[model samples]
Target: MPDYEPIVGRYLTIEVAGEACRIHVEEAGDGIPLVCLHTAGSDARQYRHLMCDPAITDHYRVIAFDMPWHGKSNPPVGWRDREYSLTTELYKDTIMAFCRAMELRHPVIMGCSMGGRVVLHLALEQADRFRAVIALEGADRLEPYYELDWLHRPDIHGGEVCAAIVSAQVAPQSPDEYRWETLWSYMQGGPGIFKGDLYFYWYDGHFDDRSPLIDTDKCPVYLLSGEYDSSCTPERTAATASRIAGAKATVMEGIGHFPMSENPALFRTYILPVLDEIRGAG
Candidate 1:
């Protein structure tokens, strides 16, 4: 066996949603485009492995971007006066705008958590626009929205507090190294962004018995849940998948929320076959 070295990823600024969002963008390999959407509060940096891994980049022009308020991106104008709040409308608009601005023709989209929740909207609203969608820890409706009214209190470090909440959700079986890496993102988010994202993830994102709106004919939809994710259980994801025609669902064992970064090596084992299936579909 030999040491594996990853190709360096690019850091670029891409304009999106009528703002000069100085976002971090990474791209590698060349085939069909694969646009990755990160979890709330986290950045494109989460997909560093996928951007660097030849196994995936070899077959797709993989790209990931940090939202304007997250990662290395600059906040849009007027953002300095108020707290950052992500809405369902803005979320989908930004995603759609990004792909169009980048000219990513029929790109395969993959997202987790809040990103996962919005991906369902993308599939239902514009299936012909994308080749396929992979939603990790995804569900039609994310429930039991939490209230962290004290998140902005002077004594509270909202980012750290949010991280602690997620730490409780990390699967016990995940490797120590993987577990910590995933939790690190939560600690790094901008003030109040994590809680704001939850407004959409846990509350406004609900589709409410509307999973049937997703048409697998125009675009293939695959929903994957980590075995230990209590937020969006595997059973919940499967039941949602069952409502959509031609959709498929699977539970990745020994994993939890944030599967991609929590355990990239293990998560890849589950994703490879789906990539092949998408390739065959093309």
Candidate 2:
């Protein structure tokens, strides 16, 4: 007999932004849906530990999907015709479409980094559709710390550059095995895809003007930032949370930007309480 994980992987074809996209999805456990969104240039693999944890799966269904052009998901038809740039509308629409397609009723959504920022957008625009939202390493705005253009330059190796830049964002305290695993995901991103994802991360996703408009009473918002995350600093996340009425913010010690992947053990110490709160609320 072979030891196997409880996680299940599958593909779903859904029409997003007028294009039929085949998305790679993985899920585990059972109960209220807990939809997870991965960081830019990475995939659902980031949440492997979360899905495998019986503590979480025992009370919640953990669902994660690789956005088109990332992970094992295939790009929409006619990829050569144009550049891929992620916009706020496109990101929100994709999530909405996926939830509808899956028939998830008021699922609790959680996202990290780029996915984190967008959850703010959802909390503002689509609050009625979700039971709650957890934003990890997220903020309303992030100043450009590195050259986005360098990510896709023909002269630079896209994977190497991306991996190198994110390497510093991982906390020094993180286990070497998990830290390298996080970087390996960056190295696997498709050409120009990392740059494209940053389009939203750096520019389109900022919610400085809109964040204050979020009605947390409609849907609860929880923002958590890793202490070592320089890109979306803990200060930034706390500031963003301050703008929204009733939003909560927390800082995970000894963790970094990619908490779920970079340091799962510590990340859980912070996340489990939030999950319990949501569960209790439900």
| Index of the highest-TM-score prediction | 2
Model 2 lDDT per residue over 22-133, tens place? 9999999999899999999889999999999998999999999999899999999999888989999999999999999899999999999999999999998999999999
| Model 2: lDDT to the true structure | 0.93
lDDT of each: 0.81, 0.93
> Evaluated with lDDT, which candidate comes out highest?
2
Error of 2 at 226 (Å): 0.5
Model 1, 19-126: lDDT tens digits are 666556767778989888888778887787776777787898888888778877777778878787788887888888778768888899999888887888888888
Shift in Å, residue 9, candidate 1 = 4.6
Clashing pairs in 1: none
In candidate 1 the C-alpha lDDT for residue 109 amounts to 93
lDDT for residue 114 in candidate 2, whole number 0-100: 97
TM-scores, each model vs. reference: 0.93, 0.99
Please state every model's RMSD to the true fold in angstroms.
2.5, 0.8
